[model samples]
Target: MGSKINDKRESLWQDRDVRFDVPLNELKLRNGERIVEYFSKIEDTKGNAGEEGKVTITNLRLIWQSKIKPRINLSVGLGCVSSLTNRTIHTKLRGKHEALYIMTKVNGTRYEFIFTQLDLELGTQFGIVQLISKVCRAYTSTKLFRDLKLRSAVITPNSKQLKVLSSETIYNKIDGVWNLSSDQGNLGTMHLTSVRVVWHANMNELFNISLPYIQISNIKVRESKFGVALVIESTDSSGGYVLGFRIDPSDRMNAVYSELINLFTIHSTKPDLGVDSYLEMGSSLAFNDHESNAALITTSDSDLKEIDDQHVAHQSDAIAAYLADEAQSKNNEIVYCPQLGLAIEKIKEGFTLESLWQVIPQG
Candidate 1:
């Protein structure tokens, strides 16, 4: 129960949000991070002419490194990326060709980067722009995993033909639903998408609520001034909103309520947080540091075995590296766990509650 989302901005930016001048040796997949796609023969237009670099799009961030000098690199987290666009910009590599423009804000400071396609044969059927756009969309849709949002524009604007999420499908829709948040309830259409329950005001589309099933603490039919209204209670982190809605025809309302309950139950079993990633059949998780093999290359069985061994060692190293960084930065403090209702140590990559318990001296 809170006011509509305002323009008040709050930042969660950290020192680790963006990194530059990264060493190529340090480029390894951390826990819960996977390479979605890789593009080579890409020119950093802002840099020198004919200076090509490789771009790796991961589940968490975008990494770009110079082909000739691997030490020159940039890593931008998706959390800080405000916009990604395709625009024609003048570059020494290719004159006035369409390039990928990324705008990001880290710690209240804005940064812009432009990268152009150097290899013409690497055309549009499956290009850098398309891949990055798809990955960015995947990240945006899966915000429930990161943080709680209220009255956000997470839904498609189309009212008639609602756009289904890549990992979600339409369940049902109820029209002529009245939201009882205001003194005079606003009539809107309620959509029961597989991922969330969305209700948008018919008059003002801006006034809407996208309650993801992950944040729903409870949903039941309750008696209110509107009489026989459906109530939804959100989790504490999500402002603990208790939303009420009314639908005409009592039986139909009951039916919709029952359907919602069933859908929530089914989704709870294996909830899709909207993260979609796919690596080709023979691709390796490791980044090939060789300049000659800048383009996408498939790995053989023998190569896979070698890569697996390296990956395990790299994962262990990565954990230690993160711990060292956390200690130096002094930012890894215990935070509140909304789900557990307790303040616990913030577990970094390659860590779990059980592992921490085993390591700690329990009295």
Candidate 2:
């Protein structure tokens, strides 16, 4: 150790007491700071999803910074990835230690993605998340917004929480569960995120592709939670695919703080337009732009009274439905009776930390 190299060498930034496991409760984090979970509201596999439906999953990236900021460092091993599927898809842990790659485009105007869904048995199934651009994109092969839609839904109050997300807030319905991350930064932690979404045909697949790559040196399997994900999808100049990305220290090669400040962070949620009202006044705006904002319903109305009204009505419905179905769920899971408004009283009724070892090894 002759010529030393220590750039403000700080000890490992140990992030403890952070978990992402839901439904399973007693959330815990995993290596590389990855934690995940999955749940089925229906007593069985298929709930009320029927013919006119396509299974889908969505990941809503909530930037904790002042504005919706994406910290992406696109480099060699890790960069932005955009995955797309022409048809609706699902993801399933047919076996343990299985994984896939999804990408999204950072730019909003045009989005294209290539989703390589891993098929251990066959190979990888891929697709694209093409944008219709306007509300009519889905209306006609000749329409504007008919083809442009995000896998998101409103979180109603019936969720049985004190204050659920506002009515205007939109959450991407990520159909499948997160098995593990490419990196092991989130190892040994748990997260309990309660959410419900518009389930799609491909409930087993990851939806909403985005940029940012992580390096996975070791292939490890871990437990998951009921967590949400944000998938950013987009296209390149050649009509190919280019997923969106986050700033990763090990990913971006030409990362500039200035470009990130101008392009990624502030623009992620509320893009810097000449005028805020400009996007709202337009008819061809994206799904979120022209509509009521998901996160912020009305900054003027403090305490979110408006969003709460929407929440109250939905909560009442859920309560009524759960109460009506209480008897049916009593036989299966004592703790969680989705049919009934009342969830299990105890947090650690089913399993404990000691028992986790038993199932963890097998998965």
Candidate 3:
């Protein structure tokens, strides 16, 4: 199931989940994605140790771009993250310093990333880590609002009350509803949360189901064996659970169905991932006063290329010099090959193909 689900969901993560050295246009926010916070001079120790960059925390993912070359960046989805912690690492730009270490799994491959704070004045290392941790926790805690759950315990057993979440708001509650899953339906109370719809049997509090807005492929009021019923068909990815509920008094049923439909539409347009980041300093970073927020973010990639150009340019020059020195020290010998059309440098005996790839940026 894990492999099949991962393979099926791979498209969702193909380009956006994990990316490196991508154009600025590619970093533009998705329909529902929002920037939570932004920090400058955050060095991706896992990528280029000497280069300082900006880190943008969003509801969906974490983005890091080099101040020198915005194209040199990384984006990791919140869904793919397995763990994150604070650790100390020695870097070329800064001598031993505390850094953010993140572990993630993408398409079955596990990866680790380290980010160090270069500017101590902006915020403490603990603050950044705690903020990210909170966001991730919120994302995990609110998965029920994004994914469909079958026969799940959405409410506390024996209590017959919904397990209210931090971001969840009960918009409506309807009593005397019948669950049409079986021939003799069970009476229950239906709950309308901000992002999901839930129903639990009054007799058996443990019998409950959760349907998130994202999973609702279709919703309609139609005739069933139990009379007029409101049916919700889930998306294929959610195992395609089709739930039905019957309510008396036609007017009340229509009102409830209309409300659900409206809420579902609103949620579909602007999804609530439930990940929020609060920073005392606000999210504004790396743009000039003359630049409008929407124009700077939505305009052509070139328009944002020169942000803090002077500072980044100086650092870029230094990095280029260091790379030049490193290359010279390698003592690569270019030789003409009979099998090949052009001259190629021979791989040194000590360096393997895997070792060579390690030097490449892995966001």
Against the reference, the lDDT scores of all candidates come to 0.63, 0.21, 0.67
Give the per-residue lDDT of model 2 (tens digit) for 98-173: 1121222232221222122232243212111222111112112211110122322212224422122211122222
Better of 2 and 3 by lDDT: 3
**Model 2 misplaced stretches (Cα beyond 4 Å):** 1-257, 272-314, 318-363
Error of 1 at 359 (Å): 36
lDDT of 2: 0.21
Residue pairs in candidate 1 whose N, alpha carbon or C atoms collide under 3 angstroms: none
How much is the lDDT of residue 131 in candidate 1? 64
Worst 10-residue lDDT window for candidate 1 reads 6-15
TM-scores of all candidate predictions against the true structure: 0.43, 0.17, 0.65
- Which numbered prediction scores highest in lDDT against the true structure? 3
| Candidate 1 residue runs with Cα over 4 Å from true position | 1-137, 141-160, 277-363
